[model samples]
Target: MNQKQEIQEGLWDEEAAQTYDSNEGVFAPEVLRLTVDRLAALAGPGKALEFAIGTGRIGIPLAQRGVPVSGIEFSRPMVARLREKVDEARIPVVVGDMSEATAGEEGSYALVYLVFNTISNLLTQAEQVACFRNAARHLKPGGRFVIELWVPELRQLAPGLQAVAYQTTDEYFGIDRFDVVSQHVTSYHFHFGAGKEARLFRSPHRYIWPAELDLMAQLAGLELESRHSDWDGGEFTADSSSHVTVYRLPE
Candidate 1:
């Protein structure tokens, strides 16, 4: 299989899926609330879709707010967790890969969202651009597509300096070794516990600037509506830690 498929399959592996939420708490309720609020304000109680809605981190809460919500997820274990959450709260979800999800069933959504740097999972330009097309197809005219991703500038290291990076709270550590010759960064993560183990997840993402993302949206027949540096609607600037970008479907 190709690298992208391997990455995708590995993510859905039962063991990995079970521990995924704990590994990534950046999308906890507080962060998700901010995302839902912004989209709700813009879309005004219309239908919504959450791509890669792993464990319903964002989808369940949005559904509780009385918005009709549907989600597409690839991992069966992740979807099982989402199903449990949905059963507890009466939400609906679909099991499928976000990149290939057709625009049927629920018809179109006023707002469709993907968060927490999940877009990078594609690991290729073709897949990423196809994601944009799929999102557009699933959106109604004048709808909005929102995405939350890291700025990618945070990985920059100073000359002649090296440091260790932590992925989780005392759970995983990585040695971030830089290769100046190749202009690439590689991190080797060690999972700490009884019988220490190591796993390597690496990718070369072309950290596109906000302007560049806007251009991508334009190419997909979407327009930028707003851009923020954080979940709290802070103005985007060079020093921003993350980006919350909102794009609109043509009327």
Candidate 2:
């Protein structure tokens, strides 16, 4: 894993951070809302931790639902934005590498969550495994660790299909280019009008299968409790677009 590339690609800078939330609403808000609803059912009143809690997209709403939430984020600008939505005194936001973040004053939580394919930000197998281990360390006995990510198989492109484009808005556009041989995915974003600019970001993710994730959890002393295809609890199948995996530490 190229640690430098991972950090540079995943962590948006101050100028880009300013418009991230607005551009993110194209898909993030609705997807995260669904995640919150699902977590609310499982978390109840228990304390929760959000890994890579970018701009409080999921953490803020979860807190609003009455869950005490803390977060670990690598990007300073993103955490800064999160603080604007919720007070730091109320929601503790720790700025550090997610894979190495220890349970500090917030203590262990009943639920530790990583969403929106954020696991891909780790970029290396060792880092990803370390993230699992760290998550286990931050969980109370029998606590749950939840992850929401797009099934990697979705990136498979047909012959002659080099780029996939999604229109986010009249001015803003999202373009994803596939590099199957290199096992790399690059997303080029274009913003028009006042916030007009073009930015290129690349993330290298090992698209592990569901069974592989289960194995990783087992290796970390966590048990795979549930695997759903979507946030709504649909059955996971070959054709599922997303995987919502839940793992639990032994009591």
- State which candidate has the highest TM-score: 2
Write down the lDDT of every candidate, Cα atoms only. Answer: 0.71, 0.77
lDDT of 2 at 111: 93
Question: Tens-digit lDDT track for model 2 on 1-251?
Answer: 46564565455667646766875452476777788898987776788998988788788888999999889987788878877888887788888778887646433688999987888766666778888888988888878999987765444566778677744877767766766665455566666666545555444455555776788788889999999988878999888878999999999
Poorly placed runs, candidate 2 (over 4 Å): 1-6, 24-32, 105-107, 159-175, 178-182, 191-204
Q: For residues 43-70, could you state the per-residue lDDT of candidate 1 as single tens digits?
A: 5767888888888777777787878877
RMSD (Cα, Å) for all candidates, in order, is 3.6, 3.4
Candidate with best lDDT: 2
